[model samples]
Target: MKAIKVAILDLYDGHPNQGMRGFKEILDRYKAKHNLNLVYQVFDVRGKAEVPDLNFDAYISSGGPGSPVDSEGSVWEQRYWELIDKITACNQQADSVKKHVFFVCHSFQLMCRRLQLGEISLRHSPSFGVLPVHQTALGRQEVIFEGLHDPFYAVDSRSWQVTHPDEDNLKKYGAVLLAIEKERPYVDYPRAMMAIRFNDYFFGTQFHPEANPVGMKAHLINEEKKQQVISEHGERKYDEMIERLEDPGMIRLTQSTMIPNFLDQAILSMQEA
Candidate 1:
């Protein structure tokens, strides 16, 4: 077996987060369980402006706190965009072994903007919960979502969203909008894009599929986070989210399905190449 190299881009800076833990746990578990010949490393993108070279076969960019838009033109953003561009160009070569990328929330927002996939903007209200996500025609056919139901649930905690699909741009790049946020009958706004296949080698979700609900619930139940959620989303929502976090049918299903499936496919593609 050829050794497979994976680079994890940490966007959380220095702030405390469950996302980093979630990624490492999933990777560690997958590696041990499969006994695959793989090695992974992490680079602090925002705090240190550190980005990986093109040596890795795959990359997973984690979600971070704050607006993806406001950070435009920052030093870190420039370096990050260069990495995206390089990998994109690398995949364009017919004979080169492909490089796969999976973008989480904050990184997904930036990817949408960079690719002109949609309108990147703030939501009327921040979305934070174990929310249901609906699939598109394309999404239903995606291998990454296999074994997952149409209206699956995942952790969505963000103020910015990728909304209003730009059909022409998507067509121009051969990208397909995959999944979207569950409709809000009373909101009178287009559903935000929850997932997209940016290309054959690139995939992303506007929610955190790698979130460990157990860890997340522990974070939320803290006195400060509990009150904060209640203040922002209401007591009822807070309680519902807390309950759903521990449910096997909700985030646990998603947690076990999505990212693991993505890595499975990515590793297979690497070996075949």
Candidate 2:
């Protein structure tokens, strides 16, 4: 058996914090399972102005707190968009058709905007803790959702989420909405699109399945201002938020199952494509 090379793309390269570290741990665990060669590469999309032409079997775009629509935002780096466009082109091409890309959190925001699956507006913002998503028929059948019953998962902390996943977005992007979590209209956006799959090779999730128990707590305690924001408008109260953040079972399942499940899907997509 040959090792599958994977690149975990981190937008916040130098800052070692909860989001980046959790993604690193996820890559580590997946690499342990098979002949998986994993590389953690950080990039400042603004500084670099583009995504690197790194030759690897798979690419995993890690989560970031920033929005892709911001002029000074993370994925706005020309190279990042270049890579995404290239991957999407590969998906569209008939002759050169082997590519796999996974986007987490804000990374998914970039993908959605580029693919025209959803729009990025500054209307409503989402914050941390365990969110329950109602799984679509496609999500239940997808390999990425394997062994998951409740269809809800806890993500550490994120500032943005999809406001609307209309049919127009879905058709234009060639994406199937996998799951969604309902939210109130005023503070949090309704029709929040939590998960989607363009195909077997390209997948995006609004939730951070990469986060673990330890990391989530560190995030809440560290980002106090963000905590206050969550406290003010988020559905979960402060203590309840923390309790879900540190849920042992969810953490274990995320690490041991969902993360690995994503890696496995990437590997399969690469081999099949």
Per-candidate RMSD vs. true structure?
1.1, 3.6
lDDT of 1 by residue, 79-166 (tens): 9999999998999998888899999999999989988889998888899899999999989999999989889999998989899999
Error of 1 at 31 (Å): 0.6
List where candidate 2 sits over 4 angstroms from the true fold: 13-16, 35-40, 72-76, 91-97, 123-126, 183-189, 219-236, 270-273
Residue clash pairs of candidate 1: none
Q: What is candidate 2's lDDT per residue for 77-172, written digit by digit as tens?
A: 566767867776766777653667778877788777766676666534446556666688877887777877655665635666666666876876
lDDT of 1: 0.92
**Residue-level lDDT for 16 in candidate 1:** 90
Clashes found in each candidate (C-alpha, N, C closer than 3 A): 0, 3
